[model samples]
Target: MGSAVNDFAGEFDKQRFQTVDDACKLVLKHFYMAKVDLKAAYRSVRISKKLPFRSKLAPGIFHKLSQAVRRMMSRRGFTIVAYLDDFFICERTKKRCAQALAVLIALLRKLGFCISWSKVTDPCQKIVFLGVEIDSTTLETRLPISKLTDLKSELAEFLLRKHASKKQLQSLAGKLNWASAVVRGGRVFLRRIINGIMRLKQDWHKLRMPGEILQDIKWWHDFMSTFNGKSFFLAKVPITSVVTDACKSGAGGFYHSDWFYVNWVEDYPFATQLHINELEVFSVALAVKRWAQNWRGKRIIVYCDKAATVSCMIQ
Candidate 1:
């Protein structure tokens, strides 16, 4: 059953769960939050014996069942998000939180879903959700320390091995990707490893360990070791708009004030022989660097024409 779920029903996850960033934003906007993990979430669902587990239709059937839970909670006054069996509830007050929890548990029980008693956190307490630690009081979010420790342990074991197999390297890259989500400027740190993995041509176990890879691993560990919790503070400054554009001649952008005043029009220098995509990215980078102080500890939207640049910013 587990193998079938992993191989064929895995895509069901994408349909039901919001992005981690979205989930964090929802939690931050509310006051009280609770995270609950459904015990044996998938096992609780009974499949029809008429259909084979490996069939493509089986995933959709399971996904529909999960969707039913989401729909039931939608009418309630609080925010409830579910990724498979894990449900996160966010409400304004302790009273509303307790009410939301009671409603959720009752609905799940009514639907024949078993609850993980130990994992059902108190609604009034600060909780970790979607692998990121969130403090309900301050609305700050950070990569969990325990996750970093586990990653380091896995890397330590891999470092001692003479050679890493393809699967091992892939797993390490995944762990790094997860850590990079909440770490500012972390994806750039991962570029070398991602490029190295893509260039593999030799047998999995026969490939030698690259010195560059080792250096990168060390750097990653040291950076994470010193990490104090990074806060995502609420926006206090009112930003108007930041528009970015690039041309063969130069790259530049202009930011407007919330009052519709033209703060400045920036004409930035650019290197020769750069492609369109590079220039597009450079324009946004320059604008951010120029206004870093003005926008520090504030939320702002960056508008750009290039889809590739926007996608990179999102990742």
Candidate 2:
């Protein structure tokens, strides 16, 4: 599901369940559940030229998507009230939920609608949708423990209160800009995508939906296509170390964010955008190596806005 659609589904999840953690957790909480989705959801919808181009092929895809939605409304005797293919059926028994799932899946299939089996949840007490946790009994998806952990990390310096050398935002502007510079850049698209990532940064503010996750997966896939061995973006520059941080940026401007991978440093392709900070860090890392060639012990301190790059030190 896309981010916008995920938002609606996420709301349903919170209203239906108490909390959302992971898909596995969801299965454990709900006695019986069903995840119904329209097959080929994006492809099925007929695109309208009026819809401006969003993603790479979103325009044409959405054009067909509109048609699919129309067909869904007229042919299936059901309209996508969720604005997507997710339909909720309340039942007391597993048999009923399974029946619902089977019926919904088959019905969409018959209408030539495709669904993402990977995303579908089958009869569970604990389920997560759009990063929201659901508890069937309480049906109030609240924030998880991990969100607190993430908030701690982002606000580490801010919470420290020492604030001696880092008083001005300009001195720390590099850190502030790190995440957005690389992730929100032109093609690299440092946005959160919900496809493959396993966990969040422990901050609800950093939550991502399907759109960011999907974009991330595409970038990685394209990255693999572009290279065979370990791809490096900066080679000529001397090696140096720097700390990196990243986050998403929106109209709210709560934190400095950009769409990026958890392991952005190693995973990002060499061909992708070479942010100034990344280049600086690369220069330092390389320069240190060159300088330490004759020495046995060498210490390096690297900081960055890119979580992936910074994660390297921890790993």
Candidate 3:
């Protein structure tokens, strides 16, 4: 019955459930914050008017129905970031934060939504929301020490194994993906694991560990051992721009007043094969390699003529 509903249910808008990253973005700059957890959130919604036969909320439709809660919160002019039933309220001042929290609680109670006071937190400079420790004082987010310890143990156990089921690989991938939110540059290390998961033919298959996958896992294990799982919000403005172009014969790019051009040898395999998109991407890569040292610790905007090259970079 659950599978049938999930399979046939209409698609819900992604915006219906605010993402953790988006929530973090909203509260990162605020000095004061609080958390509100709605008790029995799904059960609190009365579904009789929408589905007379069903008394409980179906998992598929809950998010869509929960849009009402978000709308109500927004209409009240509160600076609250909500992910499903959990709400994080942020303000620049303590007084404002307190007022906002009080008003939010009263509103929820008046609307018949139960607030779990035991789980709710008062306004403060630091609070754990959705498993990530958000510290307004430091302007940073971190994975709690307990989560880091558990992740390290899991990675160690996985490394000792020669083969693992597809489910195990997927579970580990999910954990790494979540951890990436608080660990800068962590996503770059996940490519091999994700590729390995894609190659698996069945859930029950115990696939042998690949060298690349093992290398990536080993890197994670070593890096996490000395690394503090904290990421500071940085400004994203591009510090420089590079314009690149490529043709069948050659590829070239310019960084500011400096420019570079490379002509493909007559016997070059890719150029002879007419791999224009590959050459276009290669032009950007070459430019980065040549000028990376000068652009370290800063963002660079790359302009390419081919849409294919841009799409590849985006992915």
Candidate 4:
């Protein structure tokens, strides 16, 4: 059973989805894989009849239910990773996968949770979970074609409009940032759009685009045209931390006792309008580009004072 704090209060105790990096590691080690789905997981939870539909106790009830299911599955020797209703089972052999699936399905039915047979795919060499396609044989992960198509469609529809509100601009930027999780150096593409929106005053509707913004829109189209569903390989790499700082006019970084600086060139279009947050992000990007050859296939941990900049880079 989950504690009261887990059920009712802060998110510190909540279970989060596993990161793609870690999941890919498992796929590389385990050649055989299976996926299980619990139909309407939250809706199927058997709460007390007395609890009202909109009761505050709903989350606590659900937490208890999830905890119970996790405990039951763990004790059965079927080690698995989960995100809400989806469970991923990885094994070294087909026999182990079959055994785990049988145990998992039997346990789910005994617990009274309906299983989605349609979504329960069989063991395969390649499988997709949480929008990421994992190829066990090659030890690689890539965004599925379906997700890429949807993202491209959304951006196309967004650019078609003659005028866009601040809300729409933010939505479009959010979509691009979401894709950055899988796409390396992806957030840089949205710098123009984000800066444009930030420059807007109180007037959020009927936003105007400057010449640079228009140029960026064209650049984005060309960029997407060249995209061929980029794929990333799974590798364990050593991480080097880079600390960066910036002011209105310049930015610098400290890495391995070496310091570097970049003076904001007024002639550059980006430098003139770059906000402090953008400067901080630019500093990190600059550092990465400068050292990428040496750090190829290695993780670079960037520490910046600006929270917004850090968040933007991660997205």
Candidate 5:
């Protein structure tokens, strides 16, 4: 029902969590942040009589309503970062933060919205919003301890099972998707699980968990166990540019004055079987492997002629 109703609503310009991260960067150090939650957010908004469904919340329609709230808040000059019903008010000082929070609460009340007072946080240097902990003092975002522990526990349970129902896999995928907002390169690891979900024919179907899926789960579990989950808000400027290309016989790339090339051996198994797109990706991979050490802790832009390769890498 959601999928069908969402089509009529079209695409939404919803604010991403990354935007919050970026907002944190602008006010790094000694900033106060507080979160305000709207009580029963979607239910608070009235549905139009013109719409077909009137009882439950339609995500698409709700999003449009949320955007109006965001624009109103922006026009009022509140430094707010919002995702749906969650709003994080950012300010340079505790006093200003408190003032903004007070005014926001009053304004929202006047607008016929109820605040979840228990969920509201006072102005502080750090606050948890949308499950991600944002620290203004350190200018970093991370999954809170509770979220990390829960994720690890779930993954551990999956490791003991030989298979999982489609619903179970989908639930886990959603959690991982949320956690990926703070975990670097986390989405890359989710490809296998997402692919598995796509292959399911029914919600009750059981997927025999593959070795690769188990490996990914284990990797996530181990990583979270020790990782602090901190992702800094500092943006790295690209210092190096790489141009890469590939042919049927070989692949080559150059960075600055240095160059590297690899020639496919006569017995190369994929020489005749791989498509040009695959070779293009391989060329970029080779380039990274060749110079990753030098580029460590810095950013680099890669130039690839193949649009397919670029799209694949972006994903």
Candidate 6:
């Protein structure tokens, strides 16, 4: 009767009813089988005064939602209707269902509520909500592929928006520089795409640190120079790295990454995860552990995803 989009929408996410099966089952055991649907679902109701931001189309959506509720409620035989779009107090008996539905229709009409039978589900079988399929006998909700498709689009939009502003793109650049070796290698090229952010702050520029930039450029050139042959040899050099860290949550952890010197000669350069803090200790322990009469000349590089972590180790 009253048009209010907010009345229905805010509760859309309230898991007050987790799924169709859960809701139906609760009513069945505690109540009854009378069911009704509002026609025009979303357009059946008008926007409430408190939530009248988009009034142009709110009425249509409210009407639709109301129609759906009315259709189902009117036919379910519920004498009383709580929501024009939602049927209330379903009973356990078929006769009760009809009586209840009738009373509800009379109340609505008396209250100047309009009925649109075309929108209601014929007493035929069932309904579905949040992907669950339901009926008088049982309710089965399935994972909706459409929802995932919608989510994918949402994620894409989020990424676009998240990277749209200067601050956002700067954060993204920071994340990418640390997360991707390839991006780190091509930092200069990637800078152009990210740096054109609108309204960028002067002092807060998203530029790579000078020392880091030099290291990245040198590393990139070095790797590219011998990517095919002797670089492979360099990569195969046996490496032993240690990683350690302390967490604010009162947790400490350490890790070791190793590779045979001979395997470094493979086409792919060797790679391993190392915590910058732990690697320093590992370097000392490994050298001491391997202390022998013969000195094995070997070269290896320790890579850490976090620049701060790497700096902490050196300090």
Q: Per-prediction TM-score, please?
A: 0.74, 0.32, 0.74, 0.63, 0.78, 0.30
Ranking by TM-score: 5, 3, 1, 4, 2, 6
Worst 10 contiguous positions by lDDT, candidate 1: 258-267
Any idea how many clashes model 2 has?
77
Model 5 clashing residue pairs (backbone): none
RMSD of 1: 5.7
Candidate 2 wrong stretches, greater than 4 Å: 1-31, 37-40, 55-85, 138-140, 155-315
Candidate 3 residue-wise lDDT, 59-172, digit = tens: 435655445555776787776776667888888888988888998888878878899989899999888888888887787888988889999999999889899888899999
State which candidate has the highest TM-score. 5
lDDT of 4 by residue, 1-315 (tens): 533322443344445444455555666554788888888887676566766555545655565665566677789876677666777777788888888888888888888888999989688878877667777776666666776777777666656666777877877777676565566666667788898787654335557656666665565565666676655562565565678888887888877867788778742447758788887878887888777776765666777788898788766
lDDT of 2 at 68: 53
Greater TM-score among 2 and 5 belongs to 5
Higher-scoring candidate on lDDT, 4 or 6: 4
**Root-mean-square deviation per candidate:** 5.7, 21.8, 4.8, 7.7, 4.3, 19.5
Candidates' C-alpha lDDT: 0.70, 0.40, 0.78, 0.70, 0.78, 0.40
Q: Which ten residues in a row have the lowest lDDT in candidate 6?
A: 227-236
Candidate 6 lDDT, 15-61, residue by residue in tens:
12122323443343223444444444444344466556644344444
Better of 2 and 3 by lDDT: 3
Error of 4 at 91 (Å): 3.1
Q: Write the per-residue lDDT of candidate 1 for residues 33-132, one digit (tens) a residue.
A: 8777788776887667766645655555666676678788887655677776778878778788888898989899988889999988777647777677
lDDT of 6 at 72: 59
